[model samples]
Target: MEQLNNTFVAVQAASRQLALLNSKQINNILVAVADAIMEQSLFLLAENEKDLTRMDKADPKFDRLMLTEERLKGIATDMRNVAELPSPLGKVLKENIRPNGIRLKKISVPFGVIGIIYEARPNVSFDVFSLCLKSGNACVLKGGSDADFSNRAIISVIHSVLKKFDTDPHIVELLPADRQATSELLHAVGYVDLIIPRGSSNLINFVRQNASIPVIETGAGICHTYFDEYGDTTKGAAIINNAKTRRVSVCNALDCLIIDEKRLNDLPLLCEKLKKNNVIIYADAKAYRALQSSYPAELLHPATTESFGTEFLSYAMAVKTIKSMDAALEHIQTYGSKHSECIITEDKSRAELFTKVVDAACVYTNVSTAFTDGAQFGLGAEIGISTQKLHARGPMGLEEITSYKWIIEGDGQIRK
Candidate 1:
């Protein structure tokens, strides 16, 4: 408890100094960190392998936990991209002078110290650090036990870079991978300005329910892609296949496929690509009959009521057959996690309606839900995809992590 408290205090203190750094200084540290990651890729991967050996290869989190050389290179590239982007701090959001000679300006500022609790994904260590530092907020990371070895190795590399630049290493702290550490972080009220949980719905819910500090809910993508009667089979198949199988462990991966009942004949064609990937299909009665002739008999099953709202996080998907666009919308609204949703249609009006009406961070028209990413969205990289409609509701970039302050200047005019 004492050690965790000390970590919190040090991070909170360091945040003040971090926020005072000029953009060039911050950018230089980021660039050096990126260079160091590439330099030590082999060592990082070796440590990651230690964590991987402990888990079953078939676990959905195995993919997320495992880190490769190519993935390290990608992580390095994203850090460099963050370095090139302008800092989110000190931007003037609004400025005005009142009749009482009081000039007020709303300027972007850091959240001070942020606490992030995530599971399995060690890459999140680098991502959250770069984003928090770029946005002028210090972060305390609580990575899951599943990625303990990996997270430790990654944080060591980051600390080395921070020390090389003469910056306080406490600016980014990684807590012990234990339940006790999690308890401490959740209750660090004054020390942590915000707590963002990035992982499964269970993890996010635990943090939201327990944290004494402000919480920003992220992760848990029960995404859906709707196929309208007007949808082109070729386009729909390609889009759905890519969205579902491109990276099943990711948050944007599709979990449900809503098909217009009028397009039942097109279902087999729409699901043809999925067969090559050996995807498991859990279909409702209507969709079951439509896919029985085409999909693999072994991989196909009748979907239970629980299948519709599930975040599979695996090579499995639920299919629901609907009679109209309204039915499609209703099904999505009832089951979607509001992370990402897509509609593949040649009809312009239907596409527009889907894009406008679907409540999600990223709503797509004839595009794959796989595009719901920070780097892909051109925000350099993201802390996470925010699903709630609050301060942030999409790919949370540097700007999303920051808060604003009201700066007031007086001209010595006192009212009687």
Candidate 2:
């Protein structure tokens, strides 16, 4: 057991050493990974189809978690973008010369080896590897068991690319496919610099409770969109429609809507647009009557405060009417998961103030909540949208996996 533990520790130490590489080398590895992702697109799609053969396209769980042609194309485009972004590591953080001839500098560095445990989406396998490598962090991935074949295939292709990049192919690795391997991985928490959990709340919460290693909690976008009194009904209608309807199962899609009490009358027009996009609305008592009279019961669902935290991940939404901005914010604080929130308001003061106050990873003004993505933020690719407030707050791109260390160069300087 002692010798085995030593091997585990070495894996982590090696991963960290590789993460300290210079910017140019890191960029070269990312470029190679991106090229590999594009090259293996067809193989990836075929493997995903095998997985999908067991799943239903219309199934919400399958829909939220499957790989498709468009998604693969999107992934390819994103990896190219990640390859284009400037390498984030090795930037001199600070430089100061001491009177005693000591030059101290803090520099951006990789977090060594990152342990990523995610669920059901195979495309993420490529994205996570790309981001971690670009930021000079080696990663150990454990994807959802449902995607076992796809995960292994993607990792193999990535490793092939790494050989040509002149980097340690082991920089990116995968965890054992066996279910028992997770317990072993968690116990080796000392072997990983940071652990990132991306999946359902149950999975993320499970890792948080069991792992002693540092973990970045993510996923659970029971987010919201507030329509102020001055909301452009046209814009509000369009934005919310696009958000809830465009991709119902994504993390940043709108789950709730808060309309100003003064503008409660707009609910009719709003519901009209939302329903046209095939959205099912869950409304409060006040919004219920307006919706109840305007639409059939099939188009609405009755929800209490408890429903506020629901991330339906379907063509469904919850609508609320509050008296003030404070009231709206309070509701979100009460039930939100701090993922993403947006406000549609013509008033700049209200928009700015709301943006300042909302405690979320991604907050938006007068736009769709679903725009909270790494690509939308123009970073090329995203590993995940982190819900954790520490270390990283929003999209975990190639730049988010690194840490910094103080580098001190002294000429015979001694501590007094």
Candidate 3:
């Protein structure tokens, strides 16, 4: 908790002086951070490996945060791309002329200090710093204890880069990885501006309920992709296959597949593709019966009600063969986490309609549901996939990390 206090103090100093720093200084720091990222890539990978090894025997949620060498290179690349993005702060959003002798301007500015409490993804150390710097905000990062050492190494690299410019290194600060310490800092709403809890549903819910600060809850990707009766069979199979099997452990992966009843006959082909990838198929009663008659009995079974809300996070999916689009929407509304959804179809009208009706951050027409990422959206790098309905909705980037303020510069214009 004391660590967060020191972080807050440093961030406050930076936030106060942000308006004085020109775009060149910010850009220079970004370039330097990228340089440092590339230089320290080897050390980051080694540190990550140590954490990854510990993840092997650890619990499920803890293990998911462990990273590898390839992932480390990707992180470095992500930072480089992020450094190349446009500055989000100090932008002229709007200027208004009032009836009186007053000119009001609503310009983009930085949120004072962002406090992020996230799980195993240690790369979030860079993500928060990159976005905060680009957005002209300061950040206090609290990583999960499971990857404390890894987080330390990553955070140190960021601070080291800041040191070159002789800037306050603690502008991108790391909170102590103690569970109780996290609560203590979270409750200090006066210290931090906003809280973004990016982890499990239970963890986020607790933070939202208990924290004094406002929270941006993200990471519950019990996402769904529907295959309408008028959908293209090939595209349906391909999209669902990619969404489920591409990287099963990630949040954007598809959890359920809704196939139209008229298209149930084609289930054999879809099931075959999934089976080849060793995906466990949980079929609703209709799909179970239909699949049993066409394919082997082992390929069919009645799905439980809880299966609809289940997030496999592995090479597995639960399929519900619906009769209409209304059923699809009904099921989704009941079980969907409102992260990302897809409608695999060639019909322009239906696809457009589905995109409009679906209440998700990203609604895809025929693309794979897995493409709901920051890089895919051309945002350089993503801090996290935010499911919250606030300032940020999807892949949180530099632009999303910022908040605007109405800066009124007046020359002693007193109220008459």
C-alpha TM-score for every candidate: 0.99, 0.92, 0.93
RMSD of each: 0.9, 2.5, 2.3
lDDT of 3 by residue, 248-283 (tens): 878899899889999888877766667667776788
lDDT of each: 0.94, 0.80, 0.79
Best by lDDT: 1
Better of 1 and 2 by TM-score: 1
Question: In candidate 1, what are the lDDT values of residues 186-299, reduced to their tens digit?
Answer: 999889999999999999999999989999999599999999999999889899999999999999999999998999999999899999999999999999999998888999
Better of 1 and 2 by lDDT: 1
lDDT of 3: 0.79
lDDT winner between 1 and 3, please give it: 1
Off by over 4 Å in 3: 1-4, 17-20, 57-63, 293-301, 409-413
Deviation (Å) of 342 in candidate 2: 1.2
> How many clashing residue pairs appear in each of the predictions shown?
0, 1, 0
- Write one digit per residue (lDDT tens) for candidate 2, span 107-147: 98778778888877787787887787778777778777777
